[model samples]
Target: MPAIGTLVDSFDDNAVDAVLWVDSYGTYSETGGRARVACTDGYSAYASAAAYTLAGSSIYVRVYPPAAGGAATAAYGQVSLLSAVAGTELGVQVNAVSGVLRCQSNVGYWDAAAVEVAYDPVAHAYVRVSEAAGSLVWATSPDGSVWTTRRTLATPGWVTSSTTVQVRLEAHRDSGTADYAEFDNVNTLPASPSGYAARKAGLFLGFF
Candidate 1:
């Protein structure tokens, strides 16, 4: 089993992981102690890095929506955890749009909707996902201390012991207007608040 612990990237060092821009105009960079994505062409861009396995993991990040620009059309950013890095991977996309956090988990070629959370773009929001109960749990917090549960889903088939996962920061715009999103305090923990240690222990025991 993967070691149980916590790993975090605060982005205060002005650094980011490998960047993949879906549009030539899209760019990823670190500015003002945060990882930022500028989708100049209104296309999509993902700044990603390999993260801890999900078997007993809780991933956390703070996301800020794009600043006002362009058509004011649909422009958003997301915190994603996926079984793989490719487009074909099965995982969850936690997208923040219109002051709300929306979740979509893909299974094979289908998309499953999870619950939504009230989020304010003007103010940064703390987002988290945990796999402590052998399933996926989504939550959000205003101050990082009090987290509100959003949704839960059965573990996707692609998320298995042998398959690895990644934490990704994504930005996209519907029009060719300059907009950017920021990400901060990206983290992966071995457990969540309650019952995680025991839950993880049972999962580890199951492999024997």
Candidate 2:
């Protein structure tokens, strides 16, 4: 079968149960219809759920970061694809501290062995990621149509050979200060034809 699965959450449901899992400091009620992750204690916050099992080797999503505000500290919110419940994940994010977009990877809790600085994708930008043909591509767009590739992870370990991973939303704060982020219109839609070269990938599996 071709690689095809869609999980689009407009977050209009106004319920966190719409997702498979709402773990650690992640909530869906604070903003009515968006998934919100807040980490005021200067810790990593995660909001995730099963997205889709890879039928080939391609997956991606378009996410909206929270609008600028709140404590004005160095923080970030991201959308990622995780291979396991607790370890190994890859995705694109925006760092408020550095004022730029980035490609991030995590091996375990509090263990970010890799962090690649990309371009600045100011608040509300359409950020996306796609993996196929042994590569993981990260890009950002002012609009969903025109995109600029920021970074590419070609290493084998960047994305495991395994075909299933969960979609995740994260909020990270620098110091023990109040910071929050909201995600909306999250989906598994490849950035472009070239991004998902091996297969046509785009789908909205379900809210939950």
Candidate 3:
């Protein structure tokens, strides 16, 4: 990645996710110019689950200027979660404000490795799989093939038993919300994918 203040791109495009720099998070200066990682509990705050677990990739940082703010800006960041439930963490978004990359916590939903929407003849619950961002909705039938039309769930920090359940997980961005724009090292969390076979998948099949 380029050095600090190397100018990845201007704040012309609309809000976007993905690491801007391959090896570096750009700088965002609301108050000053100094690269720093800030969070509620530092980096690597994670959640827990009875079935699946939570995990995160290496923290990726990017800077987002006011898009209209004028001044010598050299600030940026990465993103992460808000609450560590020791159970579940939805889509945790992080961003930078004033040179401090703050971690956005409590962004919940059920982020899982694999998600499929199937009819629960027992509970009568129609399932809907989706990403933490609310897009990327995938539905499955009793056969995991033919699917029905279901809506997407975009409610952050929320999961439900409605048509679209919030169990499956995928990476997402919290651009619409404040304090969740860019994350620093806070993006990296404990990966809980290992329990998929025993916890997650088993939990699924168990639901006759």
Candidate 4:
């Protein structure tokens, strides 16, 4: 198997790393080797890292979603790739109540596709977004070794042209008692030699 690259955090220190994350909202902390985000009624909790260029790289996170049966009508945990411009992002979210997994993109407008498979802590735990040659791929995994591609999109010009993009982890609940989501094994993989060649080849392929 290929080695995982560019570890962002394992949360083993029991503290959020300020050097690696910023622009946090609500409660975010490291607990028992996981990054935990507090999900309260009417509010969202999140943190972001704006350290990587979008091309030729991939970002991943393992999410343990919150359970259902609460007063909350809407609750979910998400991992997102955000362009430098606000309101432009690609994200995957797992619904807490229905366990639905939604993959969405926003480049001035929101478009989404969903997977009917409910999230299982052991069987469906990972989400990833990869960029190569002006395209973005979204996928999910059970153990990070095998991945299921969920969506593929032409990279928005705002993203492909940006010098850097952000990776965000977020959790939210609406009109309910407080709950939380756990995030772990945050990491990134740099582009390989073949990926660079693909990018070069894409120059002549014409985007959608």
Candidate 5:
């Protein structure tokens, strides 16, 4: 059986994994639609959390400039996984660049996951959320690269065992200026592989 212990809480309400997050804290550049005040030269800085007791606790972040100027817009950045306070276990942290919740995870599949959100499309420069203002979209990813649509979830599927997974959203833009996004709820969802579409959407059934 899997090890038994506390899984660890990713973050708090205003915390992506912890609370809400955004992109580009400065004014919009004439060329780049957005401009973030990076701690270093485009380096994901460490956010101090004095109260957090998790080992190696750090926040690794990435960005997606508005899809306008820089060719780097298409460059897919690697994910940054982190540890939560649920327990001693370290959850996998993925680099989120397109939606509202950037990245979040739990101890493999033994426990629930905590997610971060970020969606700042130039056309819609706000966090993408459900009508109820939830930050997660219950969907499936094809090999952890692409996600299925919102309506195509299968039933009696998406079991909540070890394989259960969370579908995180990253924000994408068409320009690089004023690109800031916001998120609402960090979700803990199950990934349906069989009944769910590989990267599409439809009716779904399962017990996650």
Candidate 6:
């Protein structure tokens, strides 16, 4: 189990905190209280947090649509829970080009389990992945208050067997133009009586 208090970054410091994350690729920085990733054409970028146990915990991030300098043919923002072992991961992403939100799990490939719907920036701004008691859940929220479950599945062997997992933020673009994505309120909360609801309540109350 992790500590009682949640780990969070509002990105107000104008710098990616090295203590909280490892910049994995591309250009990442903090500006105006949000983590920003600049992705060049036909490229991707991401950052990962320090490893931590996921059992009985929830990880989430607020993702904004990609902002492009020109006609955007393809772009998206994603949040993921990743195991150290290859091919073990779960993620949720909002596609700027397709205008859809998707949740997927990977065993060896990304098709293990998946779900998607038309994306609504207001209603699906926040994406979350949680683990509890042997099950994994994917959900989305507008204001990080009310949540709608997207998918749920039995905990994968790789995840159940791992000691810790990392949370990742990713941005990708396939267009001819460069673009960027913004993320905020990257949070990992421990188990609570009310679970996600409790966390949201605390967020509104400034208790997180």
Candidate number of the best TM-score? 6
lDDT of 1 by residue, 1-208 (tens): 3421254667666655434222223577778988787745455445344544766677677778774355345567776665653553333233333555676675453465645555554333777777765687777777666777777878665554623565567777666457688777766322344588778888889999
TM-scores, all models, native as reference: 0.70, 0.66, 0.19, 0.79, 0.22, 0.80
Q: Is 4 or 6 the stronger prediction by TM-score?
A: 6
Number of the predicted model whose lDDT against the real structure is largest: 6
What are the per-residue Cα lDDT tens digits for candidate 4 across 92-135? 88888766887778756366443346666666688887778988
- What lDDT score goes with residue 74 in model 1? 55
Q: What value of lDDT does candidate 1 attain over all alpha carbons?
A: 0.60
Count of residue pairs whose backbone atoms collide, per candidate: 0, 7, 29, 0, 63, 0
Lowest lDDT sum, 10 consecutive residues, model 3, at 161-170
User: What TM-score, to 2 decimals, does candidate 6 have?
Assistant: 0.80
List clashing residue pairs in candidate 6.
none
Weakest 10 consecutive residues of candidate 5 by summed lDDT: 152-161
How far off is residue 167 in model 3, in Å? 6.7
Clashing pairs in 1: none
Task: Give lDDT tens digits, candidate 3, residues 69-147.
Answer: 2213222222222222443333322112233212222323334332222223322111223344333332323322245
Error of 2 at 62 (Å): 5.1
Whole-model lDDT, model 6: 0.73
Query: If the candidates were sorted by their TM-score against the true structure, best first, what order would they fall in?
Result: 6, 4, 1, 2, 5, 3
Worst lDDT window (10 residues) for model 6? 1-10
Candidate 5 C-alpha lDDT tens digits along 1-208: 1111112222322223222122222222212222222221132321222222222112112233222223233212212222332331222222223333232223453334344334333322221111112222333232323443322111111121222112222233333332322221122223456543743343433322
Off by over 4 Å in 2: 1-5, 22-32, 42-46, 54-73, 85-87, 106-124, 155-160, 188-208
Q: Lowest summed lDDT over 10 consecutive residues: which window, candidate 1? A: 16-25
lDDT of 6 at 133: 90
